[model samples]
Target: MEQKREISDEQRFCEMRATVEDCNRFACALFQQLSAQNSGNLFFSPASISTALAMTLAGARGETAQEMHNALQLTQEGAQLHAAFQRLLSETRTGGVELDVANQLWGKTGYHFLAPFLETIRDCYDGGLQLVDFQEEPAAAADQINEWVSRATHGKITELVSPMSFHELTRLILVNAIYFKGAWEDEFEPERTRDQTFYLAGDQQTSVPMMHQTGSFGYFENETLQVLELPYRKRNYVPQFVENEDGSVGLMHTEVPGGGGDFSMCILLPRERDGLNDLEKEIDSATLQTWLTMRHQEVIVSLPRFQLELEYELNTPLESLGMERAFQPSSADFYGMTDNPEGLYIDAVLHKTFVDINERGTEAAAVTGVVWAAGCAQEPEPPKVFCADHPFLFLIRDRQTGWIYFMGRFNQPEHQAD
Candidate 1:
């Protein structure tokens, strides 16, 4: 008889949680950095940024890699980290939600990227490679990269780079794009949506379209904030803990064995309308994980129907997080990416994000390009009218894996500046 072997569910969950926990820590740090620079409707994707950085880290060496590990709080080593991410990518894809992740490497002609680096990303993360002549045609190169990102994000992040952002010296660009669309397990009724007064910072106010619903949702409260969870519809995908081709611990989707939490949106509403900043300051990994302990309660929910598009240049924020080495032209060591040792260092890190929340559900996308470019819900009540009428922190996550795909605050709604 053939010997029986198996990967325990605990082992796979452990690895998946480890990676996502790292992502959570990185997100909190990045959020603090980005929050310091602005007081508007702030939004960005830590998952997208980290995925792009992981690609960069794959080609990093010496102190550069160490700096990234420290900054990213990545505890796993090269191969192990990649394996964890691969497992995570596979596990996330096997759920009820529509979650798509894509990675692409674009190198300028005449430059040779090292084969080992290429192999690592391809095998571990399934990255696709493309060659573009950034040296000879910077504009065309930018357009090509932007087009790929737009498509990957389902046109939500319509573009990822501008002509001014890329130049002839650019040797390579690594891009990561994530797209997600999921409906609330219990959705809002459109007829109930009405224009309501929303208090803004500094005692300002605006009439915004606020959607209302009363339902049993995961709920928690503290002196400073109220937490509500609006779980996404999860009917289709059941997870099967299976071994991948490499015998790596991963999951496969099959007929229902057991599963839930395909996707969910968690909203953190500050007690005081302007206390969002304070509430944010209190968030760390423990707090977020603790907040997820929310119990089901009949709460009244009032969330604005909003759509937002945001673009940001992340060089300063990343450096603030102690990832300075990768951006320095002289000290940056991404030699593993190319034969020309001095040829490629990150030129910039650009990011774009989009979200549209309505009565039906939620649609969001994010694209992060390391211009080697380089580098929700709920509630009921009073059933509790948990009105997000002021600034608030929110997250959309894969509850099973603790993967936060989107996170941000809505202080005051604003039109896209671009």
Candidate 2:
């Protein structure tokens, strides 16, 4: 008789891995939504960002410890998942946001197991998240979130979120977080950075402080995209690139060797520096997704180190990016912990991010939090595009995972002016 073949535990583990991968993809979609909405830079090492979001969402929903571990695929040796959540929490606290608020939103279902995952990783982040309760007053939460958004974006983004009344039994609050950091990729000599003419549209130009450098770099070009690499002053920081295909110019950050580090791409459309109206209209989730898929046949790129500090809020853009379920109280499901079926549904999802690019490379941080409600409600605006006519930067990232966060620019200055 033929011997019976048994299914091995590793095989079972593969099935589990498949499930985790699906969840990972879902979480990545959410992050991509958040990133696209803000038109800001995002960075995450490996699966850190995705795992953090999944663990938080699972914790908020009252998932069992086993369920959380399974969903995030937390292995004993790799602290990737734990490290990511810790970084996020740390960043939030750094911005003076209360941890109690995060717990209130996450602890609703008594799923405290997930809390440790967040608490454990809190030390890695450097930002903040604030909670605004709307039940006490109409639009109070929205107003507070809006203020944080304004400040986080350095006024580039304004009024992205608003409070309203809805039918859900849970009262709602808005959670917001913001961070800022500056680093040198290839630190410019103080003498090398000087005022130079930055060409605006047509003949218009403005004198801006520009940094200059010349070094042998990893260079490549294709019909559709031009690629140039500029390594940071810290060799540990990988090089970044710029790709201009057709009219849309974007920053491309490729996957680092050995599959480590953060990867991102930024697309800038020039608009009046005063407002984001024009920038908003020209780009949406679909526009960004399409850009990612566009074929670049041949291209050339060269980018020099310059200084930039960018800030943007993600609430409005996230909703447009297809995470409506998490923000909607009725659609959100978090009833596992308490008997009060309507007690702790997510009321709002708010995020703020900031970054400063200089010679050191890119050093930045962001924080995101979800608010719960006793019950609720709910926008209009003409969109705009910031034409990115000048020497602007961009990065290309893994849309599904945000794994390799890289940065680069579309225009290179001819010389550094004094």
Judging by TM-score against the true structure, name the best candidate: 1
lDDT of 2 by residue, 229-253 (tens): 3333211334465657676656665
Residue-level lDDT of model 1, residues 253-277, one tens digit each, is 7743122456788999989877887
lDDT of 1 at 81: 79
Tell me each candidate's TM-score: 0.88, 0.46
Among these predicted structures, which one has the highest lDDT?
1
For model 2, the superposed segments whose C-alpha errors exceed 4 Å read 1-52, 59-185, 201-203, 233-315, 336-339, 376-391, 396-402, 405-418
Error (Å) of candidate 1 at residue 99 is: 1.0
Provide the lDDT at 296 for model 2.
23
Model 1: pairs clashing at backbone N, Cα or C within 3 Å: 172-373, 299-380, 299-381, 300-380, 300-381, 370-373, 370-374, 370-375, 371-374, 381-384
